[model samples]
Target chain A: MKNGAVLTVNDLRVYYDTPAGTVKAVDGVSFDLRPGERLGLVGESGSGKSTMALALMRMHKPPARIAGGEVLLDGVGDVMELDDEGLRRIRLDRLALVPQGAMNSLNPVMRVRDQLADGIRTHEPGDDRDALTARIRAQLARVGLDADVGGKFPHELSGGMKQRVAIAIGTSLSPSVIIADEPTSALDVVVQRQVMETLRSVQEEIGASVLIVGHDMGLMAQIADRMGVMYAGKLVELAPVHDLFTNPQHPYTRLLIESVPTLMAKRALASIPGAPPTLINVPPGCPFHPRCPSAFEPCDSEVPLPTSQNGRVVSCHLYPGEAA
Target chain B: MTAFLEMTNVSKVFSAGIIRRQHTVAVDDVTMTIDEQSPSILAVAGESGSGKTTLARLLLGVIPPSSGEVIYRGQSVDDLSREQRRTYLREIQPIFQDPFESYNPFYKVDHVLTVPAQKFQLAATKQETTRLIHEALDMVGLQPAETLGRFPHQLSGGQRQRVMVARAMLLRPRLIVADEPVSMVDASLRATILESIRRMKQELGISVVYITHDLTTAYQIADNILVMYKGSVVEAGSVEQVIRDPKHPYTQLLVSSIPQPDPSLPWGAEGEIAGDPESMEVAAVGCKFVDRCPVAFAPCAGQRPPLYHEHPSRAAACFRYDDAPTLEGENLDLVFERQLASQPASGSEEQAAN
Candidate 1:
């Protein structure tokens, strides 16, 4: 909604040093998360949406390395340049992650209260034990969980309950940016909406900018103000959710929007023709050219850079411009 | 004799924690039936502990019913003979939720299709076997060349799930039980898998028992739907009838909770997973959903409600349907309409929570 960038990735590249080949997982991906805005990174499986999220948080582990580009918070202090201590300091305060499969991430042996307290203690050691427990209970209550829930173990909690707990922990520090990777994919629709609502409420309470990664464009449209369409490790389109669905600029973006199953029994849920390309051996030019129906000569010969058009940053030969 | 498959007052009880006497009534007395000649999709939709999975297990004959019976054709599953059991295996097939776990990672994907054919004696010659495998794979939108020799890891989530469908097709089963088949697959890829399941009915004349918690997908694919809460079937009807105009409060809550792709229609606050776990244990009698149901009255706590027939094609277990006929539709509509009316265009109450 505003020009202030809570988090910005400038031509970020994360590659997997595999035995087969150097797999470009996040190939020159760039996007900005504005304050109080929810941005969704929508893509298919193996499309590197998750990889881009990990790179943003500097969680891209071994076998995968950040090859180039910068990750800046508020257009200052490159996240890539930070040391382990500085990275830890930057995390949970400025940048927080609600990890994938978050329900299973909690320690089953420990009580939910202890786990929440553990996270709070690691970040804010100045707070006393009682204050931390009170804060934990308060956070749990905010997500619709009972105060008694803090006393129980993770194993005792349901999938939805655990997910809410994860959100509570992720936003406990009131971080400026919250990156949730496939947060609601594991829960049912009833629980899914509940989790989404909880995430939204928590984000709103903290006024945090959220970046959610998911494969469902329709689900993303519900929470995200703007969505980035990632395909085979490249962001082909970035636009408002309504605009992305209605007036899609990129070919890959068009195909994805057309695939959603709306309530009205919208017909012709077209498949994307081919399987997602492997990062190990990506296509020569545009990684989506193999599946793109409107693929032309330039699509095969040269990779299209991010060109701004109609308030969207689209990377395609079709939308050729650099104006913002 | 008209009953192809019938579940009469079926129930399942499992012991909880370390106490043998402390039992959890997983699936309560639920009665449902599939007509003989009319083979169509019967979807069992529910939340996590709603017994949908339990019903699928009971249907597959993997677990015996603690009470009542599952009647197949004219015979009860508990009374099946040795020969009947063999025939039953071919008559009904199961498609599990996770694709990767369904098959052996060590074996080639083709083994799943070919082994069933060899065991069932569906094909004799090598050429015939090849043709059958190719056809089955092709039916699910996978090519034999690209998919056959590969391991489960080699394929995508959609591809692996389709292989499972192809394996089921090899048996040429009369019925298929797909339990949350697309829950693990990507959303866009769901259309392909669902289309494959739909094609089986038209091409092979096989009825599908689709068990899932996703209402949107159910609306898209299901012919009939049974919505369960805790362990009780709260609503059952034709897909359009139940989703479009729900009779039960639980169904209404479910229909309302669905994140409409349209940003303009914001969600209601009442049904954001606010149920108390202790509510299920408070009583042995009455509605399973009484605690969580927004419109629940005094009778909801005292006695269990019967499935009141709303439309000719639909039935719901809410006392409000017939008991409280005085509450006009317009009033209830106003109550629900107010939630939608109050909803902001884009941002939810979460925005206001700030």
Candidate 2:
């Protein structure tokens, strides 16, 4: 909470109990989200960025367990230590999650109005019907949706509209922190731009810190103030948006940035040579060392601890001596 | 020389619902051609429900176009002989979007390769078939030993898609219609897969119709670009011309909306998502993009604009180029400025109200 950090995650570890062994989905990832900051988590599929988001929300299922971590919210205490009832009370009030798939998250049977009202009543049950209805309309308007949209089911709306409804529900209570997971991945380019604009406007109005998780580096670069690069469940590098793109410290981050196809220039994409490592049997030292171009002697044998300086964190043998 | 493949005025209509039939024009009056002599990558870029997939289906001969001619090697695909049909099927291959769903999970990955080999009679003996499979796999950068005998689920998404490319390459097809081939694969692996496709065009002398919703990928590998909107081609030109200086309003929106991977280039003013195209029934008379187009005019609602040739190589389906009568072209900016000045704002508002 000090230095105006809205959320602080320290040494977070989320493990999935598979039949083979313990798969480290999220391994020792740590970062602080400042108030009103838009932080992006960029990684490929199975890189554990989504797992980190779920673990932060304490929404991980039975097979997936949070091994150890401290998700400390500013006003609310450590979320990892909260019980079922305590967690429920603070869920929509302090922290909110806008899930990956809008169709899956929104209740198909319930009208959009009732769904919004239901979330409101769960947190603050004293509001009468008229007040609740007004609140629902306001929430709908906040996400640039017409009030009549509340009358329609999830099936009736378009993909972008459904995503907006999801955003409306997540921010109905004006939570301190909003976690959007691939919010516009399924939408068209035009619609995706509109949706991201809506999200940015809403976040600015509420002044809430946002943690967006997705694989699209272009999208992250456009929206996020700072970005964290994850490889094989590890947070390899965290820096401001410009620094991350201009001078990527981690080899994986550099390759990822280069690999992203751009409209500016038609150059041969720098594809990483090897396949993404499997979580169940990750390589012995740094997970990215095998695929890294600049990997050296200490990389394959020793796990590089995270080192922090000037608001940037990097975990690699390339940058040694300054340990966290 | 005759073009390898050409679709002239292609249109496919599908009627859904039982009691009251609702017709959807999936592909509307589309015309494209690829030369047999010049191997190139032609990108058909569009959003969902834009009919790019329907166009791919038409090219693959999975479903016949309701109207228009699909000519393969200067012969009507519909009028091909039995032997010609077999040749057509083998020559033009399709690589679909989802690699996981493309294969049957119960069968090992080798089945996809062997079955195609046997059906096409690419190899005579069992040993010959094995060698072909191994050779195809090697061409895609997949180690034959590691990739073969594994189930589709066991191989990574990138690997499975590569296997699909290798299968298509097995027949040495003249043209490959790859529909969103890299969309489902992971980001890191996309470059490898696209590289393989590009390699096919360069090395094997195979043309490709690369269909995708992502323009960045299209701009990366495609030689020419066709931007589609609601089953209609809004713009068609070389990748550099279309992407750098988009003519049509829709193409401009698409180019501007792409989230560039640079902090220096931020998104502009907020854009509003218009009415859902699926729910709003489009009339058969006018332009399909008039509802969402920013620079739509009074003429757009009255009649569909033909593809006006702005330059020798570039064309756009918009009224702004209608005044440029000659192929040499006029100052199109003057025409655009004049059109915008004369347009009434209430014209679009009235159309929306209707």
Name the runs in model 1 displaced over 4 angstroms. Answer: A1-3, A266-268, B17-20, B269-274, B277-282, B323-354
Give the per-residue lDDT of model 2 (tens digit) for B1-354.
Answer: 787788888899999999999998888887777665566788999888889999999999999999998999899999999999998998899998999999999999999999989998887899989998897788889999999989998999999999999999888787899999999989899999999998887766677899999989998998888888878877787888888888888888788888899999966444433455334466577777778766778899899887777765677889888874432222111111111112243234224312
Choose the strongest candidate by lDDT: 2
C-alpha positional error of residue B283 in candidate 2 after TM-score superposition, expressed in Å:
4.1
Q: List the residue pairs that clash in candidate 1.
A: none
B66-94 per-residue lDDT for model 1 (tens digits): 99889888799989998888788787899
**Residue B226 alpha-carbon offset, candidate 2, angstroms:** 1.0
lDDT of each: 0.80, 0.86
Docking tier of model 1: it is acceptable
> Could you tell me the lDDT of residue A77 within candidate 2?
83
lDDT of 1 at B325: 30
Candidate 1's TM-score? 0.91
